[model samples]
Target chain A: MSVQSKPRVRVPATAAKGELIEIKTLISHEMESGQRKDSAGKAIPRKIINKFTAAFDGKVVFEADWQPAISVNPYQSFFYKAQKSGAFTFKWKDDDGSEYTAESKLTVT
Target chain B: MPNWFGIRTATATRRQALTAGAAGALAVLLPRMVLADEAAVADALKKLYGGKAMAEGRIKLDVPPIAENGLVVPIGVEVESPMTEADYVKAVHVFADGNPLPGVVSYRFTPDCGKAAAATRMRLAQTQNVVCVAEMSNGTLFTAKSNVKVTIGGCGG
Candidate 1:
């Protein structure tokens, strides 16, 4: 079943050239590990965001491999140096072959 | 009167002795369990870095000293780097000593990323150390660690 997923991204609106800046991201997901049993004792199928990636200016800046142990509503923050004005694309890959994406722009002075 | 079979007397004393012995064993084993978790962390590190020595600096690991819930412990890691094409952080790995799986997550970064830092939420099995190792493009490894006391277990406890 397709679920509604939302991704949030935060990036500095502006930064000095060559200055290090932080980027934070959070995504809403159930992150079910399939280990839980339903009220009727049926096993719940595992559905989690297994991979995440961040790309800037067509180059991959960061990537993460996630497991079922990641908590619900996964939050991730990372840093990148400001080289020039560009857009960062964040993508999350779910186990069910669904992908959620978000974007943030950074302007360097 | 003495019983014909010695089984009656042996059973009575043996049962009592076994109970005492079991209790004593448990008392000794409980503390060792914590140490075993540390060994697990060490083993995971060895598997990842092999014989390469990791310098313990340049990386900042932010984790709460006391986590109210183990299910969702916030973690942040950042490494000092120029982020230039010549010298940048290539990857970062996070580990939990008390979890069933020692390796929690691994992040890779390119020079275009500009900085070497990541924050995420992790599920800790119990009170344990959260360790981070950052790999630089120059083949240098930096390490940092923080202890988190988890009140409630997060790994399906």
Candidate 2:
């Protein structure tokens, strides 16, 4: 199975210069706990997205590390004050070494 | 004969009912209780604000005190910030401290964000602590927390 499904990211279309803007992101995932048992009662090996990062204009804005227990389709919402109009990149990575990325741009008016 | 009678009476009375009730409730709630133990927000909190003292403040967290749906609950946190380059808001981190992974998400920021705020929807395993931590550029951390009561559990409920 693919490690992760596509992620969705959204940011406001316009913001006042120097306004703190909100960013939202979500990933489609099945964060399986290793402790789960299959139909045959065998333990289901853990599969999880272990890390996430948000970068704005090549500078890191937010980053996180997740454990096996995180739920499927993890959602995150956060804020960054707009310094200048640029793109924000969001990345999600799994324990098996796979990565997915999404980006959103903000316009300062 | 006396010992046998006492044992039989005990099994037929209050002790038996209490034992049965506790066991039944536990059996029904055990899976949910364990599943509800995950908190991604709490994990994120420690990672970002490790070794920093967090204090309660006027920072407002806009969220339903009671969430009807456990899967997606809307939440917002706004803190008062000067928004200056020397002492502006640095980063905002939100956590569902009691969920399976306590550390749910982290947002780093700068003075450019005129104010300190964030809003998003997240899956909560159960009723838990939704904590907001704001790190200032001056290396200080401010915090606010609220308890959200969830009727139906969201963690695979």
Candidate 3:
């Protein structure tokens, strides 16, 4: 990865048991779609975060397969049931086999 | 998809005949503008569903009717489901009719997700319709689509 990638997650600090809380995640990437040509009229190579995954306590909860059409900085949001207090891990896998990860904690009562 | 580019009419050299190899080479040599259309989207759906009939219900698509910018068009999808182990949304696949490719994003949701809903932003080359399909745990499918008009195209070089 030639560019620096940053992952940010937003999870509520507290939730009631059985609460359906929204989890938002965003990452910065160019997401070159390979459809663009450079100054020399050559197609630009596609480099993007192809996969995104969310896990709670090591159990996968939500996953997304992103195509080249995703925006430059991908922003994804989903709902998760807050059963217990745990840390949610978000992973973004890039085309070059690079993985960017971020974590957020939620406390369920 | 097969018509992404047209057959080159360039004069063939003595060594390079108009063979399949040469056609392939010519395809690479020429800069052909390619964009997926409604037919491409239909083909993608057919490939995924394999002729299975998709019922039109329990699915909702949230996209602006007119987008201020094409680079970041916010899109949302929600499928009505219990979110239980026995009944839940298995996956959601999204496609666009007017993009470089029909496939936009695919989502897999587990029971841990209390709601079978997701949102993300995408790039639109022009004004087009976005189609989304959801597969349920019981082997049922649902679909929805919405059109968005873009003021500025986002996929140009």
Clashes of each: 4, 23, 0
At residue B21, what lDDT does model 1 achieve?
99
Which segments of candidate 1 are over 4 A away from where they belong? A34-43, B1-36
Please write out the lDDT profile of model 3 over residues B47-153, one tens digit for every residue: 98887998898999999999989999999999999999999999999999999899999999999999999999999988999999999999999989899999998
* Fnat of each prediction, in sequence: 0.76, 0.37, 0.92
lDDT ranking from best to worst?
3, 1, 2
Write down the lDDT that model 1 would get.
Answer: 0.83
lDDT of 3 at A106: 90
Better of 1 and 2 by DockQ: 1
How high is the lDDT of residue A79 in model 1?
Answer: 77
lDDT of residue A98 for candidate 2: 83
Among the numbered candidates, top DockQ falls to 3
**Residue B100's lDDT in candidate 1:** 62
Q: Of models 1 and 2, which has the larger TM-score?
A: 1
lDDT of 3 at B132: 92
Better of 1 and 3 by lDDT: 3
- Alpha-carbon local distance difference test for all models: 0.83, 0.71, 0.91
- Docking model 2 quality class: acceptable
Runs with alpha carbons beyond 4 Å of true place in candidate 2: A1-4, A12-16, A33-37, A40-43, A64-71, A80-85, A104-109, B1-25, B28-53, B91-97
